[model samples]
Target: MQVISVNVGRPRPNPGKGADLTGIDKRPVNGAVAVVVPGPKGTGEVGLVGDRVYDVKHHGGTDQAVYAYAREDLDSWEADLGRSLGSGAFGENLTTAGVDVNRALIGERWQIGPDVVLEVSSPRIPCGTFQGWLQQQGWIKRFTRAALPGAYLRVIVPGQLRATDPIQILHRPDHEVTVELAFRALTLEPELLPQLSAAEALPEEARKRALRRSSTG
Candidate 1:
């Protein structure tokens, strides 16, 4: 288990959307990482949800960082068949070498480095920013349709992390709701709410957000 990448971006209101957001513009577009300053939203100025800061209502995590690349995917890389870094399919803050992230299931736990411990929260649901980045319409919808997708995590013990840090799986929830399952559950399958509820490790807001999406099934 190793971190394939370390990423964080400033949540400046994307001034340009639809198409302009796709440029390979270095993130921290706001010029600084959102600090842990006191604010009206939560206990601290730094929203400790994901690894990034947003309006709370919009982006509710202090750690936008994610870990991806399950063991099955890693073998491909070792065999020189894996995708390259920065590829759209590898949308994770940290990519593990031999971890099957999608199977890890939301609410699972992992220990990275000497101190960082995180609980899987939900899958990184696609947003308009993602669509703009790839300049593809309905890109997010397509990702959800694929399922077995990227995971979102909540930092339990925040520690300094960097690319190449080893990852250790501490636990996997006794449920089948994986990142991809949650993704499709959030963006596609509304009937899976019972299983999603059983996953039990998902952040409250993410579950609520998922329940609000369209459901034709």
Candidate 2:
């Protein structure tokens, strides 16, 4: 697989959520962009050099330093929405080709280009900012129901990457918890939560949630 585009956000006023600014308006950028591990969550720091999230509480951290979505998935959404969706349209930093992002297992490692290595950590959850950005009513529900939330990645080896960089799956954890399964368990099907524990690479918050569900059930 390969990266179709590398996107970085430009800050914009967000009327959709309580956050004053949103970085959801990402645009494809030319040349190489530095990739590094972010400081922590709640600081708006992301993997990309110039991109960050405004919703600190819910987004951005080592576990969610980079978000990636498949070009194939965007094409599918285009057919459903009757509009053209370009790279970064979904606030993803990397728009990839020939990668089944949703099917990627948590802890899967990807080597991008000749340098940077990223590990799948979690799935992107739709929010009000995303809904407002798209101007689509009930978008949160629609996206959740679709279970194609994409994949959030953590920087494993910091380096530089750009559009057209090749992506190689370096490793896949021996687990059944894929991005799609994680999204479904977290959103609609609580019954699947118990199965998420198999993915030890899942973010601590999500792992705790799964633990709670399993204990309660």
Candidate with top TM-score is: 2
lDDT of 1 by residue, 58-115 (tens): 4334433343445445344335423343422343445456667776777788887666
For candidate 2, give the lDDT.
Answer: 0.95
Give the Cα lDDT of each candidate.
0.53, 0.95
TM-score of each: 0.67, 0.98
Worst 10 residues of 1 by lDDT: 23-32
List model 2 lDDT by residue over 83-194, tens digit each. 9999999999999999999999999999999999999999998989999999999999999989999999999999999999999999999888999999999899989999
Among the numbered candidates, top lDDT falls to 2
Could you give me the TM-score of model 1 versus the true structure? Answer: 0.67
| Residue 217, candidate 2: alpha-carbon lDDT | 84
